[model samples]
Target chain A: MENKTENNKMTDEERLELAAKLDKELDEFINSLPKKKYEDGWPEDRWEEEMEKHPFFMTKTPEPGAELHPLYEGLQKLKYDPEENEPEDLATSYKEDGNFNFKYKNYRLAILSYTEGIKAKCGNPDIEATLYNNRSAAHYFLGDYRSSLKDCEFALKMKPTHEKALSRAAQCCYECKKFDLAVEYCDKVLDIQKTHKSIIDLRRKCIQSLKLKERNDRKKNQEEKKKMSEEETFFEEILRCGVTIEGGLGGLSLEKLEPCFPQLAAHRVHFDENKHLVWPVVFLYPEYKIMDYIQEFNETQTFEEQLLQVFECSPEWDREKKYSPDSLNIYFENPKKKLGTVKLCDTLGMVLALKDYVVKGGTPSFILLVRNSPAENRFLENY
Target chain B: MDWKPRHEERSGTLPQPSQETVKNLKELLKFLQLGARLDLKALALESLLAMTGSEDGIKSVLCVEEILVSLVGLLEDNSEPIAKDSAACLINLSADIHGPTYLLNLSKNYCPPLQSSPDTIVKECLKHIFNKESNIADECCMILSNLSRDEHSVGLMFDLLKETQYGFDDIINIFTKVDYNTRGAKLNYLGPWLSNMTQDQRVREYILDPEKCVIQRLLPYTEYKESIVRRGGIIGTLRNCCFEVLSNQWLLSEEVDILPRLLLPLAGNEEFDDEDNDKLPLELQYLPEDKMREPDPDIRKMLIEAITQLCTEKQNRKYIRDKNAYVILRELHTWEKDAAVLTACENLVDILIRTEDEIGCDNLKEVDIPEDIAEKFQKLDV
Candidate 1:
């Protein structure tokens, strides 16, 4: 019984080993079968080459039945044959290219394509309008609002009631801050579709923006007017009390002088042409006329001697006295003479005595002299 | 004659309040509670805003249980002044260390997340931001900016940015209308918010949408003169954008022409010994001969960083090589005295030179050929 059991166990082990060997051989046989091929047995590079030669690709000509294919149809539409095709077809093809570029957000390239289409001179108004309207969108995307507005205008001229063109025109106008034009375009669009919510909302925005801009402009104008009036008042005040020294003395007239000094209205001041001096002048306190010292004053030594002589003849002359120039008061009738007290004294020594008397710190005194006055006593009293 | 009151006869100063007359927290809270008149509520809100001006006042105010929740509730008041004052008080309250977290919690509990259609309070704040009245708008912008500091709040802001009807564009429009100096201040906070929001890939994609064109909108602000901090913020946001590879390609695209825009702010005045001045970018060619150059070193460093990031792409590297960017960068690198700026310039020069070597160009010497002539030579080499 033990021998029989051992023999049976050995047979069981041999049966298991035979099954394992048989399964390995079956796997090897399956692995040896040929692998399924890709792209109909063609390698990747060769497949690409074969696809390029296919009738549906971007080529000059397509297969006859391939016209039904979308890509083939697109390529066929864009293939411009100068001899067989009309310029309108060429223009339309370029317009389609522009639309493709626009969809891809290549605004500059789309603009170029649209421009090329426009140059093709397609006579179809609808096609031309579509092209111009599409170009406006590209321009608007590029922030060239003015150019966009112009293209919209061109589109409108071709097709006055084109809804897309009008709506796009409104957007371009709004971007350019031409709110009135935007409103006008929106009105046109609303006329076509009264219940259009987007257009209605846009029109409302345009109106509100227009009102705000007008208010700002009106405020600016009022401020500008106020500034202009203030400047005018300043000039009027200067004319009333002061004279400009810019033109020299020759350009002076009584009409111009009357506003500054009403006293000069009655005086007949004459201009000496060669000497460039005012005539009919008097030097009352000095007891000498300006003509007497005019020639001598031009010479330095004679001018100094004449100044000393005039000082010695003063009413309260004192040779030993010291005076301060601050105490000396000199007055001229015409403040517009462009001359200081020292310059006037240097030119005419009639006021030289008063300069010395005052410089010595004497009691303050006035030396008033008039030009072209017939009065014998021209100097006003000190009081 | 009638006898005058003793307080009236005294000096112009007001008499000190008696203990009974002094305003307490309970009375202020009662004034803010429902059923109060609009004027009384506004007065209470104003007082709270003034009180929160001090750190101690903020601490004392935050201690009240429902006071902050009431303020957030009042943010939707129909009366503009009441809403404005409430927003202002909230802004002040947000200054404390725990202030933002507390307010953010209140917002989360009371207000809907910004991704879902905004709640009444969020809408009210946005309305005030775009309102014709600048003061109210300023307060709203400040409140929103403060709230944006928290990570959850930033996520909410990103959601708000996604809502097309009233989104980032509206925020940018309000920013554009703000006075330049104030806009700069507002940008200080908004810039960081923008940088944080852009970390999400979806947010970056949303910003780069052609309809939005956020990068183009920000480019012009870099040249703004009202505030360098504002310009710095804009540059910082742009730097954050460069972290994404796709954005770098878009920035260097022909439609964007970002190279000139990036370089113009860094171009020093003619006083510098830039021998390559003739190679200045096309956008800068029309600037008046005597115009002053950018004096800030921080702005220059930001510009260099933008350029360095842009050079990561081969297409961008070729464009920079064609534009003669190397000459300008070399000149700036040599002439720069600031240590940080010099380092940035050095990094840019290294990238530009390394890129040229990678493209098989061996000798890297200074070439002074005319731009048009150089174009011809480049075509031949290609």
Candidate 2:
């Protein structure tokens, strides 16, 4: 046996030309292969539905007529000469090659060898199933669940009672997050051998996950229902208080949509223990670029009453005797981009009901400025 | 033409059932409630299928409220035909807002009788869509596609996807694989279904999450030739996602490089000189002679609109212009026949032809459309 190989003397252009020629020859070889009759044919789905099933590795078939690999091979002697090695011999050698790589933990190389063994099309069903099952183990090590699952399916198709293929399929389904499919595979395995402990453990894990899923769904359903009904209550109360929904803002596409009234997303709209609608209204003082997030404004309270409560401490931002109940003017943006100023005498519900009012971003927003001050002039200029 | 929702192509009208119809549906729905008489089950499903055909009829059926329990229960029937009709009837009911909302609100009340069965309509549908061997899986995917269309229904679906591992990541895996399902379902509707779900800002954020490769995987499917339904759905989804102005730079940049995809469909076989070709994206340069524009007018309009949305930001507009997008649009203008697509193309071209200096603004979205007279002054350069 010769241990050493001869070095290539081919030029770059020669190599390129040879590559192109080989590609053309390969296509010709594939084209010349006989059509498969589906009923008696080996698995097409297993080979990814390619007509030339298992076109993994093969010897070059000599092209026609020319003493060399030949051109216009369709011309004279385009004989389809395949490899001379018996399929059984090639398959067994490749199986040993795959097992050698698997022992060395070279899973990628192992996968390649197992694939070639499967492609050899040996007549023995047991050898074919082993090849498929071994390839599936390599894919599992590589964390390719979908590929591993496909290989398992092919192995099972070859040998229905194969324990490894069925168990591997169950584990692959679990990793793919198809817990129900995992359970089905587990059941199939248990049907064959009831004393399989690891298989039983996998089944138990899958069952627990499914139960957790149902429990999570039930909790989620109840929470969503509670939120919907609660929002429905809050929205209905505001509507009853004469606060015109939409207010011509057109920000909302529909009129009847339960006001988003999203709690924690922005302001909270809820009912107080007194059965009054309490809203967390936001007040913008544009001059200072500060906002007073009024945590609780009972809709029944008047602007004067709330302002008195808001300014009771002579708040931090008001350095110039500004923003008192007597010295403030409130305005909101109307749909036409004009300012509709409100009188201090107006209540929160009346202010909300004003024709210019719009509940934007599930919250009620208002602009507050000092009367006849420089800041007031600046606010109006932007407005 | 700018935004063609799937509601138009869907069967039947809005539900508006009256008291008398509600009473009849309540009584009729009892067939499945009684359990396991195949003949009665068939008769009831057929009658329910008829009622699901009209909005008035479905509204009447929904009045019973527990109708979800009865229909989804039959999904596990030993009889395939009866189970199939059960799935079909559920699909019709879930097609519109009224049905999906009712299911979302009260699904717990209609819990399945089987201890091991999925607890709610959505959880059951999600499970079935992933489990391909089930005969009713395709119908389950359809039910999900319709369920995710409305904003209200999307909240619960989005939440479930987030809490469980079967999030958009898993959903996209099933969607992109042609053979993910053993039943030969292409899952084309997942495209529109996902597009519809993007109406929620959270969904848009999830797909567009810079951390994840979700949107990048979808970019190649703009050229998927198998199903126009799938192609159009992805294009619509991309357009909806482009509405997020903050993501414009990323979408146009090399990471996603969405401009080439949007322009590729509008491009044809028209050859450009080397100078023009050099400025274009590598994919758009020197296209083969047999290259053709997208055949569907609505899809053409969507591609143009997506590019237009990307142009709202100034840097993205500059990036698009430097790519020599005009040559493709120039060729498309001559070849295009659809009026609406042509207008969309013109709008995009109008922005590209003018320099940023001439447009006199950093962001087009902020350049308030002039008060009638100012537009005449701005058009003076043209």
Candidate 3:
């Protein structure tokens, strides 16, 4: 072909004839040189049988129904002499493979290769730390920052002065939002070499992030405390009132009722005994009441007089046609008065009468007058 | 005996009704007073309809209190022509801003002889819109369309639309009919009517079907050639629909294919000539060049908004990516001059790119960043 090209473009037919003549000559040369004796002039089948007896062919073909060797399955390779290779040399080879994989961005494969290098236990702390540090990088690129931190810790254990491991441990902690740990790791690196500007920058960043995180946590704690206090005040009011309101059977303790009224935080409530009858007892002056007249109480009439005044103004008087007793009027005026002309009703009876009056289409004011002993009265006066 | 105004010949000049003409118009109004013959009253209303056809004529007739009161009274006439002619006069009268308010006030004050309440006069006008009589229906729809311009009457008409169930189906039937002139008139009225009604959320529930497929029926009208009002109405309804996430998803879904339909209005005059144009839906394929370049920036802004809202959903973001929305939006962002539309295009592009980044489809080659930007970055590095 070179002669044809160099001879200033030979005719197409001459080139074809020369190519055919050379092909026949080449065939004759190949046929005459290849006839070799097989030591016994073996037939084709006999040649195959002889080839199978060779170690190369014997290993290539497995016997039928024979158990397969472990090396022939999966990735296992046959070892010529396993004891010849030192642990350190084997680990170095694995580390090189890991570095090659890492350069190509095959981070998962790099991680596996580095793990294999670490498991080899080469007894060289330098190589072990290098393996751990390399695997931490692979983990960092894969966004497994926690695992990266763990590998960095292992690297530091093997060689405490490993600068790359310390810097990477800080980076992983920072990525993981573990800012305090990040700052500590950066401080370790900075302490070893004061002029490490990158580590110092990282420490500054971590401190700034830590401060931001602390501020956020403080704000969150304050909001949570405000919510808790509001909830507590709501329950305390309900307990102090000892009355059931909109949330069913509200006289239950805070523990039982908190689940029902989760959103009803610190809202003032007024109880109407006729409206909610679940409570066994009703108090005339529940502490939860707003008590707008507390400062005026000393200048006004006594508590008994106030109670009689409310009873006289009750609409139940008009509906039931039950007039206030003449002796009740005298009780309102005198300091020492008892129920002589009127039959004294208990709290439940008075509540039922008020309810009955409301049911009869009359609005009534309810005031349960409790005749406390002198000691209880003196105790209430302090409030 | 002959109170009709003589037909004056002024050869191509608008009738500036003389004092004599106003006097004769007043005499015709007296004939339409209570207990007048139905035919005579219908005739008077038709004459008044013709007289009120000009701005000056409407001004002259509006000054005559008896004629305005009688025209509203004629709305409740037993004869359809009288009622329709009365509504037609009111519709023409309502072309001016004060006209609908004037008619609305008349409807409030004047009780027709047949209907006890004055408000029923407006209701009767709406009732005649659904009448099988085309003239009556056309005139009533036109009147209500004008009345709907006022915010108060729009609420009242929206309530009437709900009460009559004369909703999307009626509007679509009128719009899609073969008669172009009638469709134009009806859509001119129905568009603003529908656009105003969409402001009320309750009316929107009636506008959107239970299966949420009503937008599909409304999307085609966005391309109607004869009426820009109809297109505005459809785009306005779509803008309102995007206020909810479910409707936004429906708009972006393969079922509605709203992205391409929305692009129709925003596309420039260039014919879609790309080799890959076959990938577009058949409705979007080979559309008449400049078929949907809305001259109004407001309508164009609404189209951009509908697309932006659709991009809010993750699935819709993926759909927008598959449909090559980013390419169209990039072109629009460069070509668009309106500040609001440009902002919307930028926002939509940012959302699409951000979503693509989140999904790791960060093939920067697919995005069309200018080469000069890279050159600028190189200069900065140096």
Candidate 4:
């Protein structure tokens, strides 16, 4: 026989179980040995402690054939030898053992017995299907719906019209939250048995869940359509405002299309409740990276009005308090990639009307600088 | 002495401390503690950093537990220079193969015993790591990345991570949020650090737990763009977690739906027929002509390896086959320049193309892989 350590790969769970077993074995081995003393260091004996450096002194070494441990020689033993019994007889015996355990509520033991019966390769399809069907019940009782469903599939593969497997499979799908699949499985079982009470109740529960899900999904879909229509209106308004959106080429990369907040990113520009055109705008503070995002910047507000309200309190990162409404300058990158300054006093509509200004991804971003400070000059030199 | 070739070839040993420096290290200990002069603390930490720069110096420093304790205390200093240098020293110490045990078990053996502290060194590292304004946050992350690299220390480091307020969930949250650090600290190194932590079986259990909803959060980052270190680290973490061969079926199923995330990176601009496209996951469905394959060959190899691990079960192998994963691997095989990655691709393809009758097994895991061969397969690096 090959060494246990050779040609063997264990699962993570198996390895952990082995580790615990090894730890226990080692602890028992150590405890059985007599203690030996040794010095740790320094004054060395201010307080005493015992150290057992080696177990060899007190433990008995197993000589070839004459000790408590023999390190068993010969074939590694199997718990049950399949070669000794005929497949059908062995399988029937295992099934009887499984049923006895299942009757007594020893589900785990019943599963093991059923698994062994399945592995017996009994050749008889009825016995094989029964083995898988019973194992599926054991797994379901253990709250392992997925494994139960898997076994049910295996049973149905061998015996297509197995009523118990089909019903259990439907129940497993329901537990797994696959409402549509559960409904399909339920129909399959109904095709076999026209009216089963428990199956009928399960079908009703599943239909209710599907109905609730559909209602929620339809409500969500309606909100999305309404948002899309509003976004279409905002596109028309952009043309009315005469703002150029560079279409097709050299436009915003697809990255800008993924709207994070307020759901559909395409609707960054939309009409406000008051019939005013509202736009999402980004205020970039190049120095501190503390950006101010206004998701509903209406066309009536001037650059001065917004900056005044945002910077009224000296922002915490701006310790020297350089940025103020009057000193702030707004710059936008034109199509030719030149930084053109807009007057802070100019209304949001006038800035949108500027010949060189173009909106990308429905969001117009502007850089803010405290006009004549070093931070402003540094930000200007980059463009 | 025997003139041994193996020993001679292995001879790039680190610089040891001079006897005088080792003897006088106590003087530096005073400055390295919590309440020392700022400049003096900086100077002492700098000296300790120099000591940690070598394996021998680290060992000598380890002998003095009080100095190690001082280094832990100094990691919280208000001065960036001192705190950063203190973190640098810990990174060096933690990187040493022998250092994790000492760091974890510090003050346990001290003669005077130890004064109680509110936090362990790990707790302090995590506090600074989570605090955005802290300059040494990334440096503290580097210590964990360095510590967990050793097999012996992975468990110790995970234990330390458990003690901190920032858990694996919090750690993953901060890592995935691009540009989360406003102080210009990338914290991308957390990727590999996470990979290292997964060596512990418990960490894998926590991440793979279906109820935690943790593994799904990491799936999208298989394509994270900013830093390759982060990308590679995440891929490595995924590969390591896939070692739970028993969990492979659940991982590949809709519960986790990991196959597409693994395949998307390997697929390129190559076109597939409508029939083929219908079989593929939605993420891999039509070709975008500009689409690029994962650039790093090592990560490509890891992604492929993760798939191979998933392939061990019959259910997952069927999922991989049904999802048209072979088409992506076929395209990858043609374009792959790395020999290591191509071999891995070929191995995965070998399993996929065969009929159950030809393979003769219900589950490939039942076909045992020899321990020796499994070791060689794992060591294949692209």
Candidate 5:
């Protein structure tokens, strides 16, 4: 009964006190529940939601000890570091693979690696030079000299005085026997390091080899000259000694004479048989034995002379003399005595002898001799 | 060197059967007949070869058309000796006016033997024939020398000298006997052979050989009065050996320098003007309008064929490139109606199709051309 008036209508101070005690009780209760801890120390689905909302937050923020955000590191460091994110990892992997394969003899794989590294780096000249030089060596070993040379050229382009690259390039040029290029590369190498033995020695070898070749070539040419001269002399003797088969006067014209009567022109004599024309007396006496005469004939000398020698020949002499009294001798007016003439038959036997003689370097002068005619008007007359 | 001792002894012991020694009915018939049978082919070949070494053999070989036919056939034959014997015979024949016809026949059919013919003798014979008349035997020797490019054929090329009793100086006779005015038939068939051989591997080998005397023979030819033959021979020889020599570094460094020695003669040849003659000799001068210039159409037609042969030969074409191919092409483009120059123009066009588009007619500045003709040079755009 007393409760009716007790707290129901308590004063405002009593209500306030009660409310404060309730607030304190509520705060204590809220604080008292076991603290909710993330098992992985992150909010539930926090990363996933953050990635979807503003992915830049995770990417742009630097992880502890990551100098710059790993993703945002400049291209140069990304290419060098081994433990970066996907893109950076890819570049590092290529660089590592290139060096590894290059150390091995797997040049093709190394080239692939280096090329990938270059791609990853996007045309850095240092990387390009490495790729080119390594590939050049690979190509050189593969006997692809031209390709090797090309790569060396590229490598040289990047670092002009790269001695190893230059030496290798020169070696490739040498292997391809591109002496000119080899000398050029060697010169470049010498410019970098003036007394490199291998390079100097190679240049020396090239020079010596060139000199030896020149000397040997000169000697060979000399011998060739000697042989050619001998042949010329042999042909000359054939023209000189071979018999001249008389042809019809119409054939005596300059044109016909050149081909048919080569003997009239006195073609040069062969080296072996130039002895006969010491005197015209040799022609009249015919004292030289057939063998001796044959020795002067060079059958292989020319086609016409050989033709004459292979065919048969018969000699006919016509003598006519005209005594003009004013001329020295009026004693005998023999028509035959005036002009001395001899005719050669176109038979096979005589021609062969003449041919054989000419081939063997014999010059039978009677075929070419023309003298002692009163008017010097005698000419070959045969059809 | 001593490989044929037994054959030499046999030859000495036997009464050597003369070409005319056919006393039996069979022998007499073969001798009397112009053609030789299969049985007589050997005898005829022997006679022909014998004639090559001496003047007698030349006459003996010339008398037999049968031998000539056999030789021509042999030039095409798989049998090596067939060509070799024929070439030997041709060398003898070429020295005579009548012999040139036979040489021409052989030149028409000559080609290097197929690999099927293992005998190098045949290849050597082919080389000899080419050496005799490379100037005119362009196709014949080119085909044969191309065949002789193999390692085996190259090894046996010295057979050209089997009958070479004379030395290098003998080469002088090839030009010395005949004046520039001479025509119709060649006095020395070797002119063509030498010209042709210059394009051959065997000839190159001979030129490069330390022991052989072929270079000496070539020396006289270089100074020859007939500039065409001289230049043709020298340039052809250099062109043929270029690949081989250039491939060998040792060789390239040393011997490669001598190309100018040969090229100089060609330069001189281009300088030679036909002095005081309205008509240049077909063999001695380079006349673009020669065929059309002839009074007779038939002769002009023949000249056309000859000029075509002179320019289109593979070696010749290469020389043209080296000497003044582009300039000549330009000149030919502007010049009149010579069948040869026209065909050459077609060839030049084909060549342009393969040449790099960047290399234009401007490269021709190295060669000398008349200013009038120079204006006509084409810049072939490819």
Candidate 6:
């Protein structure tokens, strides 16, 4: 009985050994197939689908002791779970769709999808902000400024600190001509960030426009008042000085004095042909015959004549010189003694002072002395 | 009365102090601040530590910060004897809470220009201050190893590395020294350092030798008692060898096997990307063409996977292309049995098909006599 049992056991062992050897051979044969030979005639898509069905990316084969379900199975469970189908999930799905639509330049679809996301997750700050921010951009693209502003305000309210939301809100306000609100939003952005040049420029433009409006209003009011006042005051000052000053110390009529002053403007002395101001006053006011007066004054009978003579000695008293607003020459003259002592601060100022004293102020014999010009070389040359 | 022995009389002794404790403390402080006057300082410090014990001395030193400051000053002394004495005193006192203060003081005072001190004695003193039973040895080794390789300390450093305890890390750290006194001194001293090293030691030596010295000695040290040491030794050796092999023309062709040993540890960790390492494992596998047909599946699998990974990684594909890896991969594909192996083989086939013939893709089809696999090849829509 023992010998029979031994023989049976030996045969059993041999059969098992044979099976193992064959398994090894089969494995080798399958491996030996050339890489291309197996892939050549096989439907590549079908193989890929089959591989996906079996979870090819998994690190381990399905076994009894494995800790978790296969990745495909887990993903499926997650897909159908009630919790996964909640508002947050809906929001996420809609958001992804919106992003995809946005990428494809489907702004209309993107707006719809983002709106759905906002509706599903009303309490979710990020979703709410993103939805409104995105819809604002869509409405902006569509040229619906009112709707864009509405959506942007919603976004800003949901997340008060949202940068894109605030940016969009500002843009919407700007588009709608709500310049104050636009500037306010921009100021908010600037408060959060001091270096946002675009926001700063926008705010600056808004403020400038408001200021321009105020300035235009002020100008309009002043112009109207001035127009009425001009009409009311016309007859008094206009008729009073129409081509004439009624009173004069020389007993000269305005028409005659106009020509007379031209002669008086030139010729500093009575036929004193060597004097520096003689030709300037003579040629400009040839009829005044101030040369006789100047010659009498040169005789120096009064203190005023002596003072006027001091100005006559200066070369800058040559009245033919042109004066500009910035002329460096200045001449100081004391009119208390009715004497002109011309002192040229510079050539320009000195000439201007002399012209003003005699022509404009009608001051006779004023003392004018050059404040800073060199000593009167013209007198020395004549001497 | 006549019982006085000649030996006892000849061995003279100093009289014991009334305050034995104070006497010991004085001697210990002197020893701690051992100066050029070696015997006095050593005897004094040794006597004090022996009398006081480390706890009392350490406690006293910690309680008295001023004493520690003085000890630091002594350690930093210019005279070798003085510095060495001070280092001993600090080392003894280092057991105290004030010990860290000594290290802090040393770091603060000696870190900069003094770190570059020319005197060998001061450098050694600094090094000794760092060496303690505590893990401060790591830091000490670091400072010493860095200091020793300095231009002024290179001669002294070579003498230091001759000590057996200077391990592989030390050599690597020391090799980073740029301002070593002489290139010849570096090379000349390296040969002797490498001569007596075990196989593992040789592995580390190869890493340090920029100019590959006689490398045969390193082969034995590779046979280490611990697998970690062996593996680590391999990694270190190969990391250094790869630099020598690829860029260094002076490196030997026989040392090509070094690259294979480098890739051995990489098999377990997927994060160990050869792309970052520049196809080192693939280069290693290619080094031995006959190994492809070796019966060991594990060896074959490692080689194929590593090469496939190398081929797949975009950064390393060029090297793979350059080495004509596709042909061997095609050869492996003909015999590969495992499913993952088949995938790798197919990838190798795909890479070869895409690669230009300059990379030796022409030989891709010549190795096979299998029909079904060949037919799969024909069906590929490249």
lDDT by residue (A102-188, candidate 2, tens digit) is 988989989988888888899788999999999999999999999999999999999998999999999999999789999989978
Cα RMSDs, all models = 29.4, 36.0, 32.7, 34.9, 35.3, 35.5
Best by TM-score: 2
Evaluate residue B224 in candidate 1 and report its C-alpha lDDT on the 0 to 100 scale.
75
Relative to the unseen true structure, what is the C-alpha lDDT of residue B151 in candidate 3, on a scale of 0 to 100?
Answer: 54
lDDT of 5: 0.43
- For candidate 4, report its TM-score: 0.47
| lDDT by residue (tens digit), candidate 2, B235-310 | 9899888988899899886557788888888888786776897788766766665778898999998898899888
Model 6 residue B122 CA deviation (Å) reads: 55
Error of 3 at B288 (Å): 7.3
lDDT of 3 by residue, A1-383 (tens): 88868887778999999999999999999888969865666577687775554545553555556655444432223221235567887788789989998999989989988998888889999999999999999999999999999999999999998999999999999998899899888867866775677876787677667655654554455456557777666655543434223232444333443212222223123234433222221112222231111111111133344435445674332344332322232111111321111133323223233212221111112222233434335434652
**For candidate 3, what is the DockQ-based docking class?**
incorrect
Question: In model 4, how large is the Cα lDDT of residue A239?
Answer: 73
When summed lDDT is taken over every stretch of 10 residues in candidate 5 chain A, the lowest stretch is: A324-333
TM-score of 6: 0.22
Q: Order the candidates by TM-score, highest first — what do you get? A: 2, 4, 1, 3, 5, 6
Candidate 3 colliding pairs: none
Candidate 3 off by > 4 Å: A1-383, B1-69, B73-85, B92-110, B113-122, B162-188, B268-298, B313-315, B332-382
TM-score of chain B of each: 0.68, 0.87, 0.64, 0.86, 0.32, 0.28
Write candidate 1's Cα lDDT for A316-362 as tens digits.
Answer: 43233322222233343333333224332343323323223211110
Clashes of 1: 6
lDDT of 4 by residue, B281-337 (tens): 766766566779999998999899888888877767888999999999999999999
Question: Mind giving the per-residue lDDT tens digits that candidate 6 earns over B196-291?
Answer: 122232343445464433233343223232333222333333333322222222222233233233233222211222243233333222122122
Best by lDDT: 4
Q: Any residue pairs clashing in model 4, and if so which?
A: none
